[model samples]
Target: MAASGDGISKSDQLDSSPSSPSPASDCAFSSSQSSYMSNAPDPRPDIPSPLENGSMKHHVNGDSGVNGINGQMKATKVGSRSWVGIYESFLMKNASQIASVESTLQHLTYLFPAKFKDAEIASEVVYSALGILGLYHDTILARALSSCPSSAKYQPSLHTRYTRHFTTRNSAYRTIAYMLVVIQKTELLNEIMSRRHGGQRGQHTAILGIESIKATCRLALLRISGTRTLVTPPIPERDIDPNVLDQDGPITHAEAAEEDGDYWMMPRTGQKMPQLKGETDVTRFLMKKVLLPDDVAPSPKLIRPLTTADGRIKEILYILRPLVYALLALLAARLRASKRFKGHYEKVVINWMPWVVGFALEYVCRDGIIDSLSAEGGIRAALTKITGLEKRELEKRSNSMWWWTLRGQFYDSITKPILDKMIKKAENIPLLNLVGLYITDYQYLAETYHFSTSTL
Candidate 1:
């Protein structure tokens, strides 16, 4: 921004005029060539000696200095271009990896969702959000991580804002959520809020109210037009036998449970060892605790009946079950950023409650995850990923599950506190202290940016 004594700014230093180099360029050239005169060169008969001809010496020195300056300028230009190219290449690679991870997670949710968690729908809209003129995912991510320490530039991104927009909620909820997450860093969302509602907190309250109603109406329409209870095909347990990963031939599956026994996962023996259940170590314990297997590891049934009731029973509660839960989910999704809640208790509740409720609903219906290998990724998924068409249906089916993690409350509340204590203890250790620093940065990133916090 500002430059010292000579008054040439950073921009001028990088792109100075050819005839007049900046002070930095001049100083660099001087220091680099300071040894030039002392270095010995082979004597040439045609060259005039400085001692014999003073004017000839000045002429040669002046020409040599001009040529060197011109060369330095040319090299700087080339280097700048090269640097930009490298930066872009790395950015695209990161985006691709992000998309891939999101896709995998979404499918995994459908196939092997957390004990209580429902399968994630097509939620890969992130990759599509890229290519925006001034927006970059990494830049937004950096801002999010930095904001956790202070909410000075932060805004509670509520789901109500975009839920009314059918195409967007279906496609770009994550991107839109992400855009809101980094509202302060990139002024686009800020400008939008200001333009629409006079930029006042009070002014926007009415919009939220209106949006809440619209969202309720939309969900009502979906419920009325849809089935009374959520139903899906049962999910299988194991994808393939781990022992088969070491083999070189096609594996066999039980003919009776062909669809339930296998999945589309690659069998790689590299960098992996069998997970022994006998180990008492923390790592093994954590690996077991992190994932819980499905309740019924039953053989695949061709036609599973999810509903058991034969009809009748005109009960109010039963009739309103979908609406009540759907509304509660909307409320949870919209309430956090309202500033009315004094604590993040609601956040933790939203993160896990719907999941628990989902486990029950699916349990009663006898339906689990519906299988689909091909699904289009959403904007979040693409930036975060890209899923399949049927994949979108999975996300739709995931409705009513507490997706409170969208704002990343669990990481900040539960994971952060634990990791913070661990990092502090690690801070005093030898090699562990170095690892602490990396984890600390990553912790902040995960806290700030909830894009990777998938609904799956």
Candidate 2:
């Protein structure tokens, strides 16, 4: 917030000053110089002429303009740093909620074990999601470990279980989310490259063009045709030639010295393929399942609409987004209510109530006929806890399993089918087509509903 050393911030100056002068203003002579040459009366004798005095140094050689730009750049850097700090702090503060969401999501991944065809594939999906989210790495692990409670309820075994689940799921959910984002980015890259090249393909434009996408599809097929594991040639240790290195020092190997740049390089029988930018092994695995090219017909065996494992996994996460938000909101409410924190009641209600309501609505939709039965069971439990007279009797008589059975049936018969249909429908639309529709819809809605009614 400090001044830009020109007496005021560039932002303040821009706001306070008039619009910049027209180009014609550069051709005009100084009024004072013109008056002096014409022998006209001095407009103000008391005023020091800018040409004689150094007070107008700001105007000399466009130094003011340069200073303004520099100030703006500095302000931008400061703003970026502040924004990053705020985002990191937000992530840290919500680590527990994030951990819970991830744990639940991983458990949900188990629900679709059949969808993945095997336990290993389902586990792969889970791990892929984790890797994408950076949870597989130490990035979120430290935060999660620090935020967990060190109370009696969280015994060593319980803590270990919690940490294990947190690490596994947090990364998995993040991975799935990141893959969706990457799909959009890659699609955009493809479009831009195609527009620039107008169909004629070259190596540089290949990644962003149709050729790259076709190459990816072909690569995916080659991968699917073989076992998932890559077979590398075994390196045999041999006595190094003393002449290989003249001095007793570490030496770079010839193979290590070659920096591979072409990501689209096809895998040869005994050679390794160059790694794709912004991709992990897990990410690459998932992308191979669904990445389709504009020119090629999508393979029936590959992921289509909602039929493929990747599509189903992504869709499941999409449907669960509301639950994630609900969990976060509830966690935030607990944080706000804790003795250490202070916040407005209005804010708590404003931020928390909608999530609570949405969660309730979703629960009702999911449970259908079972919602009332579950509510009844919850109320009965609460009453028994308060009375304490028939706690043992109530526990013995509780029909929780009956309610759960009904809920399960509702999910299997109604909710799951509807979600499956929706996922399938989504698959019919190309990824790029979906993105374009979303952007167009967003723009239309913003223009129609915005206070300014901006057409842009």
Candidate 3:
């Protein structure tokens, strides 16, 4: 009555055997036909009727009455077998589809761009893919996050490996740079530092990270001033190249003085060559006429002696300048933190605060210390008067206001543009003090040892 695992029914066998009788020929069959039917044995057990057996079977055996029944049973089994095969095939196909979805999700998670004009749309695609993947392979994503590096160096690796795989129009460098800061990946930070020593690209990444670091420092300073809601992030360890030196060699000095020197008569031979008198005279003439009168000349006036009063003022200015700058910085940072400002405008304010404070301090120092002292006169007055004149001359010589102005100009011309590029590049990396950390480590080691020139 029921089919087995092999999918064949007992009734199916009986229906196909030959020499079986037809249902309508029981009473009127010819003698020869009757004899043939009687001589053949029934393949199936005899039953009272279809109701008794609880199933029906039609004998085939060239029996005319059962022709349609045999055909139908045969067709049904074949069709059933085909349907089972199709179902199994569908299952296997979907298994492969699941794997593909998982692979796509992993790639998307690692390489998702921070900013996109169609970010919501892209995110939907990513989410859908990830959701499908997670349904089958959640462990894969967990493992990736677990294995992620903590240092800054990994940020570039991500930029090169993951970000490039995504949209070509966006910056992979800035995206990973932001992630490195946001995620606070120390391993990635170290990797970034190491790369910085490699080539121009690495150096560029380092410089981008440095801007973020300075902003974080400013924010911290602001918080201390009670004007900012955000606290200053930790300072990163600085990487100081031990080989950097203050010393100048003979060749360096010569090159620096080259504009005034007689190039035509200068050594045109080996390391040391004969010096012509005519060339020496010409150089002397140029030095007096063209170079000496210029700021480029090496003169005593260019090298101001550091006096006790000057040092004291320097200390005061340094302290007061940062204090005032911190206040402004905090105010700007608070605004940013409050979400009242964002993008390029927020950055401009943050960068401008320090320069503004420096300018204000210069104005105060010049007018209060130098100008005020010179106005009071006597023998104690004469010395005070002389010093005040010298101080004012030095102040004028330095063009302190001009220096601040130039600094502001530099911020606008160079720093801001570079910062804009960096911000776009570094998406939302963790706040790791990349530059500070490198510099600190270098300074620490340098202080721990005293080295000879050969050792260096």
Candidate 4:
């Protein structure tokens, strides 16, 4: 066949057209024919080929090499999806569960010995669960505190319940104390106080709330004194029954005279008792003169209670007035000395003036300083001269500038209103002592160094 210009090669025509039979099909046909001609058993096993098995092993080992890079791409896509689902389901739902957990804690409180027995275990479980769930919150803690009774019904058997199951017993006591003082929960606190007197385990638990108990007592006393009405139960007086004799019988006049001696008699035999010589002896002598017996009878001296108001006032003034006068005199002298020295002394005095004033006022008022001044008198004097220096030092030590900032907040929130009303209504009544009570309370707070600026 001579080649024409068209050429028309059979292989070229087959490759270009869809109607052509494939080479792969021809090869399969040929292999089948060869197998048929051999008539021998096929050599290939029914098990996977060595090449196929090797490819699977590479996939299992997470190897892209040999298996090709496409397999690793498939795996990374699957893993990323799983991680995203887990994070969303666990971490994102935590905020919604906190309230439910807090409610569970409150409900658990009422269950008695059963819960008490495994209280610590229960607490651990709860905390662990909450942490795992990521639901722990401050509101849960505050809710627990507010709901727990300041004075629960006194049940001796429930002592174990409180001791064991109350997870934050100390914090609970402190919170209750703060609330009672803040809210003035007198009746509830009184019940707590009465329960305290029963000498039971429940009371012991309640006594953990001691500040509340004390505040209740003080408020009751003040109310009674202000009203002059015995509305509240009387504070129990310590009884000294005459029939209850000492081991040596009732304190005898002769024995008392021997032990305490006759201060005014000037020693019957003029044999000066060595003991009756000092300032203490002089004080005893003066007391004897003022408290002389009316009759010759040497029976035990009965001390008369002061009946006259003037006499009580005079006694108080006698004890306090001299100290006040001395302090005032000292302050006046310092002022006068500062005036004489003028510029330098003025600066020195000014630097120490606050402390000097603070100390002098504290001495006169019998109050402790908020910040303890240096014991070295000179340094204290120097520091006190600067205005507000004492207060600044106190703020520094206590780390509470809020005290200075919120100076009158407690009074404004609580004391001042009550005092103004009491003053307006009970002007005739001697309620000045109530002011003294406030002063005493303030002094106590200062002495304890509890100047909580946040509280103010």
Candidate 5:
């Protein structure tokens, strides 16, 4: 048990292995060393073996040899699987259905972060996003574009952000081709034109935000117009009768049959060919000027003089006739309102004058030709004479049993007889003097503000 000079006890020296050591003592020493090594960190720090404390092995700042190898492997596996299924599903859908799938993919793409695993997959994403906003189809494109102006007003920043991201001219030709194939091409072109005219917001931004959008729309418009998609169908030939005489020209038997055949051929033919016969005074004047006299034969030698006279008369009637009638009517209305004409004269001015004037106007407008005028014209004959209204119309009025029952006989006997008597009385009155009085009274009234006169 005594220590030797080399600082080894005699017992330790005897226990040391020298050529052959005792196996039991060596085994006991190795077992004690193994027990001490159990609490130390592992030599392989790259693997994610749990720490002695049972905590996850962190990748950084380790006292050990390495870190994060297992974490890197896990991330690689996840990233590899990311977007793989999305890419496969996206490719299987058609363009119309792609929009719905694209929305989900976009959300996934945002939620699950990963680099595009393949170029084809990236392009498919781009294509799907474009389709979601209807960039690929014309009908949907129109709806999208039409709604853009409104969206630009509210959430303008967000609107601009997405607008610039989506719209590209690479599919311009394809878009135009699709729109042309639709039967409603004209309506679609009109919608685009109206959108252009309606104006767009942010169109002039320095970023060319809406301006670039308008340019794309203009390109589509140009494509449509250039292809003549807006061209209307050709009008079919129509049968125009050269010998038609007057506003109420009689239809010949053969002409009527032909018209019936045409109407039978095309049900909507009458809707296309509108008739405006004598609906206006200008039309009436033109008709009269163009129509030939039935009593006189058309002579080429007299054509020049007749045309000049007809034009002169038409101009005079178009200008002066309406003015003269307006003036007379105004004078009659004023006279009816005057204090002197309130009682007995009120009836004559209000009721009688209008009836007489109306009848006279109808006669002049309808049968005022020189040949129709004769010296033997009396009040009774004038009342009985045919004018614009036919006898059939008068008979129809007389034979209206329901109207007679509803309105009573006062309109038929009293009102009609009085109106006829007034017409007869008004026939003898000189129209020249009445016109002169109107002019004189008009002048006197105009100067009344300057001087008091007994002209009233």
Candidate 6:
């Protein structure tokens, strides 16, 4: 029993010992378990390690930090520019105004009918004044744009586009100025004369005389103010063989005497033409003693632009048409004023047909509709192929003719009628109603007389 008690006490003391070999083994096992948990790859790979997360964040922050530094450098450089550099951008260039101010005002006339309505004299004065101001404006703006370095290369093309041939260039201005004379003969003239003279007229042709002088002065100004002539396209100095001139140089004095001023002897309307400046002597001198096969060559070879210059023959109607209308109007007025004539005949005949004829003549003459009647084709088609005009360019010109529905007589005859019906329908539509109702002023304008009852 004593031996068993001693063994039990030894086991109890060993269990209660502070530094036992069992405890040390247990400590080693616990440390190994903790190391295994830390070093082993986790089954949940979805949860990233704190070290991996920190590495990814550092990489992203590094990229963002570089970008921010670059942007700040760029901003500092731009912000350093001086105010003088900013001002020089706009200040160095010439200030300019628009060239189409007159056309714009005319188009806008429908917006203010009351100002231009029955007051013919007032309207004429206003339109003429604005037209003059616009001419000066165009002149100044042209001076400005042409002086610019960027636009200098395109100056010639710009001039060609904006300027017309010599004959037709001033057609509109000339017409307006001349109308200033006859415009007084219409309602405005009659009203003024009647108010002062009280129908007891004693041959008051002095007003006509004054207007004629004024018209002459206005024409002189137009001649002085605008470009007088265009530079005629460079003509091939000689188309004939070199030795061909060795054949003949006949005296053209007789023929020249008979010819008025058709200096270039171009294809013309046979009407006496004034000597326009900058013409080339293309008389080929093929009228030699011994004629070559080339001399018989009758190609319709003329300057490209001059081919259409003859179209100015019809444009002369600009000057003649208005004068004719004015004279006819004066006759109609006289007939109305006659004690023998009275009611219906006067109203229908006096101002009615004159306006229609004049308006039609204006478009027909100016827009080359008359020339289209005898357009150059077949034999002349080869000759008419203007330089620099390609087949595609010509096709573009042909296609653009479809846009003529918006201009000239086509507008009066075709476009306006269709637009009238469409306008009413458009006015009924919700969003589109604005286009037809208040936006366009010409939709309801009278076709016969321009600006309602105004003569011009």
Point to the candidate with the largest TM-score.
Answer: 6
Q: Tens digit of lDDT per residue, candidate 5, span 304-334? A: 1112333234322322322333345445545
Sort every candidate by TM-score, greatest first: 6, 1, 3, 2, 5, 4
What is the lDDT, from 0 to 100, of the residue 426 in candidate 2? 71
For model 1, residues 200-238, the per-residue Cα lDDT tens digits are 343244334433443343334334322222112111111
- Residue-level lDDT tens digits of model 2 in 130-177: 534533223433322223221111112211222233224455433433
Ranking by lDDT: 6, 3, 1, 2, 4, 5
Residue pairs clashing in model 5 are: none
- Preferred candidate (lDDT higher): 4 or 6: 6
Report how far residue 29 has shifted in candidate 4, in Å: 99
Off by over 4 Å in 3: 1-315, 340-354, 366-369, 378-410, 413-456
Poorest 10 consecutive residues by lDDT, candidate 3: 447-456
Give Cα distance to truth, residue 141, candidate 5, Å: 32
Q: List model 6 lDDT by residue over 1-456, tens digit each.
A: 112221122111211113322221222122223333445454445644444556446654566655664455444443444343233222222122132334577555434533444544455446556655544433333333323322311212212332222223456643543354334334333434443454423223433343344435444433432311111111111111211111122324433544654444446754433343322322322121233222222221111222344444443454355455555555655766775556776566554655567556655554332243236664345434432222222333345445434433446567787887887789878978866754344343333222233322
lDDT: the better of candidates 3 and 6? 6
Candidate RMSDs in Å, in order, are 23.7, 31.3, 35.8, 42.5, 42.6, 38.0
Task: Please tell me which predicted candidate would have the highest lDDT against the true structure.
Answer: 6
Worst 10 residues of 4 by lDDT: 229-238
Angstrom error of the Cα, residue 146, model 6: value is: 4.0
Please write out the lDDT profile of model 3 over residues 225-327, one tens digit for every residue.
2221111111111121111110121222334345455344435543332233566554633432331111221222222233335433542453345345434
Clashing pairs in 4: 350-385, 350-386, 351-385, 351-386, 352-384, 352-385, 353-384, 353-385, 354-384, 355-384
